[model samples]
Target: MVNSVNKRGEKILIGPRLRRLRTSLGLTQTRMAEDLGISGSYLNLMERNQRAVSAKVLLRLSETYDINLSALTSGTDQQLVGELFEALRDPALGRDRVPKSEVEDVVGASPATARALVNLHQRYTELSRRLVREEGADEAASALQGTVPATDLVRDVLQRARNYFDPLDRAAEDLHTELELRRTEPLTALIARMKDHHNTVVRILPNDVMVDMLRYYDRHSGRLNLSELLPASSRRFQIAFQIGMLEQRSVIDTIVERADLPTIDAKRLLRTTLANYFAAALLMPYGPFLKAAEALRYDIDALAHRFGSSAEQVAHRLTTLSRPEARGVPMFFVRIDIAGNLSKRFSQGRFVFPRFGGVCPRWAIHEAFASPDKPLVQSVEMPDGETYLTVARRVTRSGGTSSAPSQSFAIGLGCDMTHAKRLVYSDWLSGNPMPIGPNCYLCEREACPQRAHPPLGRALAHDERARGLSQFAFAPDH
Candidate 1:
């Protein structure tokens, strides 16, 4: 039964995953079947999706090949499928209509080819933007020669690792324990450690003195200056971040090296990201934080208060609790600005954010802008019928001056609905979940007044004699 249906009560089909695993292990159908004590014909049928993988077969596969059951059943392929579909839907491609089922089939059959196509499309899009912005032929030719953007490369690295760096986590935890952060205030302990270990003096400067920089480490003066604009939580985080840069440089560099990134900019960005991860781990050590989260029923405010972190920090940290031995609920986190741009995203779960465009307007994350600083909860069902419990709230970053206005963004955190009962926010869940899509260009939801663009590959259905709730209508059946 476990292999028969996923948490959403839908029949699970892991043919691609099973075949990929077998291929990775260098096992033929007969060999793997022998290992699992199943007939070769049965294995072939399972690999071809002609037969459902029984629980016994799943357990046998896990026991024999040493695979995580979640890895086999998770919706990881959906991200690749969605990205490939979006890439093929590009107007510039000028290809005939490609159905989503065909896209999924392509991913299932040959994920490597699908990923290559998606990567090519990304490069093409980046080059196209550069061509639009710059008129010079030399500049346009240089743009065409550019590889994937540094940001995208760094994001791909993080996503591939599932945002969890075990070595960094363990190192930060060890440091936290050695410093006895539990006995004293985190900021004070961090400051003492910085002064004692690194001979760095932590200072808070006035807004005028710091000006635009939130944090600046003066190497010659041995002073780490933090802007007065930062709150207590931010100051602690910045101090920890500096400590990480000094202490964890080797470990961060090793990780970046192993990632085999293409450009210097990508390496630098990844190093900073890893340092931020180390900082969060130092503030909220994995063991204590995971325990407190469970005790508080995954309450964001409670966890933030307990760890002396901000809501956004707490949400980001939640996505990194993917330790094999002591795992927390798998979750996804995203940050969106008022203009509907996704500034940040990380997932240790099945949910995938749209790669190129804005998110679905119906998502509660957008509604959080209306009631800033207050948390909003909703149960949302994607077009694939997978449901998730999402929590969204507005977080503000102060500029500390009238001339420099503050910036506000919506922070979204979500997990599969199956894990919703473990969260305190589940109390707000409604029986009817809001139906949403990845984005307007990919969504086929009809009569949505919030629909900003007609779905790609679907012909617009215009009739002067009739009007509907949506301004741009399309054939849903298409």
Candidate 2:
């Protein structure tokens, strides 16, 4: 727990968190300053975290807004410190020899730079891992060899765009307000808007008529058609997405243009992705959703019920709560099929998604299949020594008929352990954390019994007389 004041009677600095809380409540610095009986400049400095909030101001903040004091003052700085420590340990960085005080100074004085360095290190790790894996494989032998899949390329484009588009988020928020969605049923309101503003009618077509098509818009008839195979939530989502394409096309296009994707397919995919993102933002307004998430302790089922969404949708939305002004917990989300193929992934944390192949089988996401619908929670430590709290569950997609094929995928959501206590799933955690890695070939764990391949660039020692705990033993790098 953070103290209200330091031993020297100095106020605790919580500028960034204070700013986030104020912004989440839509309060300006001047108004918040007046409410706290302080000067606007002082409030500004506090918001920037340049100065600490005095005990009096802290009490006033808690009383006035019902702020979660502990949440407002914790986790972020510690997370930065941990990431910096991990990044400095990269063999390529050679920063292990540098004094720790200098690294701490860098983290304190310029956090953005520290974060950038961490991102660079992750990219280095990912690219190095990829190159090493492809060293000897023929182009035909590897699908990822000569050409990057448009999916991977599109993912990189979105990552470079930081997974948050200000214009699109703002547009969605504006639509939410314009439709007066808060007071009424969002689906009904959106339907009325589609009929009134876009002169388009939504029709849910039977499976026979649509036949494998989930959604299609007939421009000539000004009609939006959706297959009945989709559930009610997916139906509403498709309608909302159509609204995004029809109304927020300019915003989506502008963002896509700015992305400067390398190919036409990538651009098209990005446009569709941005439209879907806008739809989700419209469905779950940022400020309200974030407030509800904190108030509900990030209960996924509760959030889904409150927002009239599905569990997977809520999980995906949690990863997008990086609006800067009203940020939520930084999280990483991934969806994978039973065969261990990554269908989708996004990260707002320091988590590294596996880029080369199937993830390590030791991950709990795979184990989640045993119970089918129930969520399995785990505390896992990465090879780099950072711990994360993760929850995984299976989501089933029905084919709307016994003959049609049904698909099931596991969705995983996690965040840094520093923030885990705030989640309901944390209560179920016990015992030591499990050790895991992104992928086998790239992981350098010395004695992992599950390792499938030796790490690249390490020399293997073959001795008839000796055996070790691990199947692969390596000579020390000189």
lDDT of 1 by residue, 271-380 (tens): 99999999999999999999999999999999999999988899999999888899999998889999999889775454767555788889999989899867999999
TM accuracy, model 1? 0.69
If scored against the real structure, what TM-score would every candidate get?
Answer: 0.69, 0.69
Tens digits of per-residue lDDT, candidate 2, 327-366, equal 8888888899988888998754567775566677778999
- Cα RMSD, model 2: 26.8
Off by over 4 Å in 1: 1-147, 475-478
- Least accurate 10 contiguous residues by lDDT in model 1: 132-141
User: Model 2: number of clashes?
Assistant: 0
